[model samples]
Target: MEEYFSAVRKMEQTVMFPSLLQGVSLGDLANTLDSSSNEKDLYESYTLLKSIKTMVEDGLVPLNQTFPVATQMKEQEIKEEEDLESLFYYHVSSLYRILTRLTRRAKAVTSKYDEIMGQMNQNEKRLSF
Candidate 1:
């Protein structure tokens, strides 16, 4: 049961979550007038998501590092009242969840990388023994 749960979490972090994150184009979301509201929401959501990804990749801090605040400020504006800040407050709970998942993924990836390296080193030692 424990092994099964670990495998499921690994799959969630590495395979499923990344697939959801990839191939998003903010530019296309920015364009398109008629559907601006929906697109804008998507853009904001993805922008926050990508920023979190960048922080993880850049190693600014380790996984599970607490973000400074809920919402990051961008130059462009969305709706007057329904801007990113407002949306973030409204969705603060979900944001926490997303951040937690991302942090888990970041840590999992690092752990997997370290494990592979350790295995390689062990094999090298065995071969040289």
Candidate 2:
């Protein structure tokens, strides 16, 4: 889990941030005349990824026992106690999956930006990433 978080931080620090700073456009996915809600610009994606990382860094996970979801939980689920280890595994697995996906997305966006910039050295282009 820590490794996955670290990878996301690295992506933000090394790839996405630099690409964004360079103004490598992602084709204005948001301002299109008939833009669909499903289309997210790379900058928006980067901000989301950064916000998630910030939340994780700030230890903002809701560990409260009486959280809102507690009321919505099924009676059977309320009565049934989940094993801590299993819950940890579930969350860790979920985190791993999401971090992996975000990292891949960051990489793809960087590649697209590099293409837009028409960079010559493939190795140099991806060196920081």
* C-alpha lDDT values of all predictions: 0.45, 0.56
Candidate 2 per-residue lDDT, tens place, 14-111, comes to: 56334453343445422321233232466565566677778777875565645576556645454554665776686689778777766655555545
- Misplaced by over 4 Å in model 2 are 1-39, 61-77, 119-129
The per-residue C-alpha lDDT of model 1 at residue 30 equals: 31
Instruction: Report the C-alpha displacement of residue 106, candidate 1, in angstroms.
Output: 0.6
lDDT over C-alpha atoms for residue 81 of model 2: 49
The TM-score leader among the candidates is 2
Cα deviation of 49, candidate 1, in Å: 8.6
TM-score of each: 0.36, 0.52
The alpha-carbon RMSD values of the candidates against the true structure, listed in the order shown, are: 14.0, 8.2
User: Where in model 1 is the C-alpha error above 4 Å?
Assistant: 1-52, 55-88
Score candidate 2 by TM-score against the native. 0.52
